[model samples]
Target: MKKYVQEATDINVWTSLKEDTFDRGKDIREFIEGLELIEGNAFISLDAKWGDGKTFFVRQIEETLKYFRAKQMETEEKLLKDLESYEYLKESVAVKETTVEHIYLPVYYNAWMYDDHNDPLMSLLLVMTKQCGGAYNTKINTKSLGERLLAVASSLPISIKKINPATIIKDLQEGKMDILSAVKTEEDIKECVRDVFNDIIVEEAEKLVVFIDELDRCKPSFAIEMLERIKHYFDDERIIFVVSLNKEQLIHTISNYYGSEFDATRYLNRFFDVSINLPEISWYQKQKVQCTNSERFWITLIADELSDYYGFSLRDKLIYKSSIESLPRDVGDAFSQDKMYLNIFEVIIVLLDMVDAKEKKAFLEGKSNILIDLMPRIEIYKKYILRSFGIDIRDDCEEKLTEKYKLVQEVYEYVFGRDTEEYFKEADISRNLKEICIKACNGLKS
Candidate 1:
C-alpha cells in the first residue's frame, strides 16, 4: 500500500499515488544517510508545490523512522503484558523482542498550530513522548521551563488557546514533574522547547524529527509565528524540522513579518543549512490527448494553447488547436466556404490561456458545429490567415501573415538560436493576432 493519504485528519486509511515513481533516487538516498546521523537537525525542503506529492514523501520518511524505533525496543517476550502499558518506561527496562530490521514511528506536528504564537511547548512534548511509546504521565520535571505560560492557557488571546510551554518540556525530561501552569518569559519558552528535543535524543536515544506541513496555507500572521518559532526555538542538534511552503506566499508572509526588513534569503539562512527549490513542471512534459484513425494526438500541446508564451508543452498546443479544429461538420452537407471560415474565425480571437486545448476545441466545435469544413481541402491556409489575422489582403493573405510570423520567427531564432518559445513572444503574437482577427472578420471585410 502507498504510505500516505490525501486527507488531513485521518491517519488510518492510505491512498496510492502516482508520484511515488518519480526518479529522485540519489537525493532520497542522501536524505536517508542524513537521518542515520544521531546529532544535529537537518533542515531539508521537499521542493514541490502544494499538490505535487509533499504528503506522500513525508509519510514515507515517517514509516522509515517508525521501523527503526520499533527494532530498537526489547524483545516481545520481555514486553510482558504487565510492563507493556506504562507512560514513560525507563530505558533500564529493556524489551526481549528478536532483532527487527527497523522501526516506523514518526511524530507528526500539525501545521495549523503555527498560528497561535502562544502555543504551549508542553503539547508538542506530549506528542514526541507518545511517539516513543511513552505516555505523558506525571513523572517529568518542568519548573526549569517556568510558570507564567500556565496562565496564558487558562485565558486565551483572540480566542486562541495558549498552552504552558514548560509543562510539556518538563514532562518529556523528568517524566515525573506535574506542573500545570505556564511561564511568560521568552527565555523560559525557548528553554522548554529546546529541552524537549534534547531530552528525546539524550534520554530516549531515539532519532528526533519534526514534520511541519502546509506553511503556505496559514494566514500571514500565523505563518510568521511559525517561521520565528523554528528560527529561535527548534534549532536543536537532535531535532529536524521539515516544513512545506510556497515561495510567493512565503515572501508575502515574511514581508509582512519583517516589514521593511524583508530579505527572503536572510530569514531562510538563519536555520536552513541547505535549501532547495521545487521546480514547476516544464513545457516539454508530454501527455496523451486523443486518438484518431490515422494517428494519435500524442504530443505536448503547450505551444498551441498559449498565444504569447516563449514556449509551451505539446499538450498546450494541441489543446488550443482543438478550440478551432473540434468543430463538427454542419449537418446535411452544407459545406459553404463562408460558413467554414466563419467557424475557424470563432476560435482565433480572445486567446484564453487557462483552459486546455481539448476543452477549447470542445467548446468551439460544440458551439459552431462545422465538421465538413475540415474535410474539404479548399485553401484552408488562406482561410486560416484571414480569420486569424485582422487584415484585408487579396487572395494571398497567408503569404502576408506567414511572412509576418516568419519575421517574428527570425528575431526569436536570433535571440534563442531557434524557435525555442514557439509562437509565443510579442513579435509572433502580433502576426497571429492579426491573422485570427482577419479570419474572424472574413478577410477583414466582415
Candidate 2:
C-alpha cells in the first residue's frame, strides 16, 4: 500500500551561490562582473517569466557579492583560509580587488512586499535609512545624508499617514522637522531633495547597487511610482539599479498607469539601460532537435504509452529506457523511424508526479496494459499524441482515422504481441476506451 503525504520530502534549498546545481549562477556572476567595469549610473533588467527561478538566481548573485565584500574586510591569513574552502572564489579577480571604486553597497528590496506604501519615497527612505550604520566600512556620512533625505521625503507632495511633521520627527527621532517647513512651492522641495541626493552621492565611498525585485507583481501605481522615483531622485552616476520583472507584465503595469491606448513598451524603455532574458530551462522548453538513432524515438514512444497505465513516473522513465534498449533489434528498428511528441527525460519526470511506488512498479514490470486505464482519459494526451504522428484531429477522414489506428495497433503488438487485443478487452477497458475515442471523433464532427 502507498500513502499520499502533504509535506515536502525532498528539496535542495540554496542559501548561497555555491549550491547552484542548475548552472544559473555563472551567467549572473558574469553580468555582475560586466557591471563592475562601468563607472556611471546605469540600469539592468533581469527578465524572465514568473516561477522560472529568477528570485533564486538573483539571490545567488547577491550572496556571491556579499561574500566577496566580506572577504575584502578579512585579514590576509583568514582570506587565504576562506579561499581554500570556497573554490569558486579562487579564480576570480573581482573578489581580490581592494579598490573602493570597485566596491558597492548592495541593497535588495522586494517591491511587491512593500506595495502598501502610499508614497514610494517613504518606502525607499525606510530602506536607505536602515543601512546608515556603514556596514561597508566606508567614510560616507550616511547618517547625515539619510536625515537630509528624510527631511526632503517628509515634505514631498505625496500623502503620508502622519500629518504633523513635528510629531513625525519626535516619533522617528531621525532628524529635525524644520528643514522645509517654511517652503511653499514644489520647486523648493525638489531642489532641497536634489541637493541632498548630490551630497550623498559625493559622500559615498563606493557606488550604491539597488536591486528592486518583483516590481511587476506590485500594484500598477506602486510599480510606476517606484520607477519614477528612482529615475528622478536617484539620478547620480554612483547609483546602479538592477531590477527584475517580466517585461510583458511590466508593460501591462505601465498600461494600467497610462491608458491602454498608450505605447507602454516605448515608455518603459526609458527606465533600463540594458535588458537580458534568462536562458530557458530544458524542462520548461523543448529540446533542440537533432539527428539521433531511432532507438531514442522508440524509447519516448514507450514512455508515452506507459503514461496511459502508470500516469507518470520518474522511476519508470529509466526502467522503460532500459527495457526498450533490451528489446530485439527488429522491435527497436520499428520505432527508430517513428516520431514521438514528448521528450523522454521530461515525459518520465512528469509521470513521476502522477504515480505511487507500488503502482509504478507493477506497470513497469509489464503486469498490465496501461493504455486501457489511460484510454478513457485520452483527451489529456490526445493533442501531443496526435502531433507525434503528424495528425490534426480536426481533419479526421475515414482513411486517416484507419491509418492512425493501424499505427497504434502496430506499436501495441510490438509491446504485447498477439495478446494486444485481448489485453484491451479485459476489465471493460476496451468498451471504456472505445467510448472515449467515439466521443473524441464526434467532437471532430461537431
Top candidate when judged by TM-score against the true structure: 2
Q: Which digits, one per residue and each the tens of the lDDT, describe model 2 over residues 298-351?
A: 444545465435422222333334433432232222222222311322233234
In model 1, where do residues sit more than 4 Å from their true spots?
A: 1-20, 24-26, 71-105, 113-184, 194-205, 278-446
Q: For this target, which candidate reaches the highest lDDT against the unseen true structure?
A: 2
Candidate 1: residue 186 Cα off by (Å):
3.7
Measured against the true structure, the TM-scores of the candidates, in listed sequence, are 0.48, 0.54
Candidate 2 clashing pairs, residues 3+ apart or interchain: 294-336, 309-370, 312-351, 312-352, 313-351, 313-352, 314-352
Off by over 4 Å in 2: 1-16, 76-101, 131-204, 282-446
Local error of candidate 2 at 382, Å? 10
Candidate 1 displacement at residue 275 in angstroms: 1.6
For candidate 2, give the lDDT. 0.53
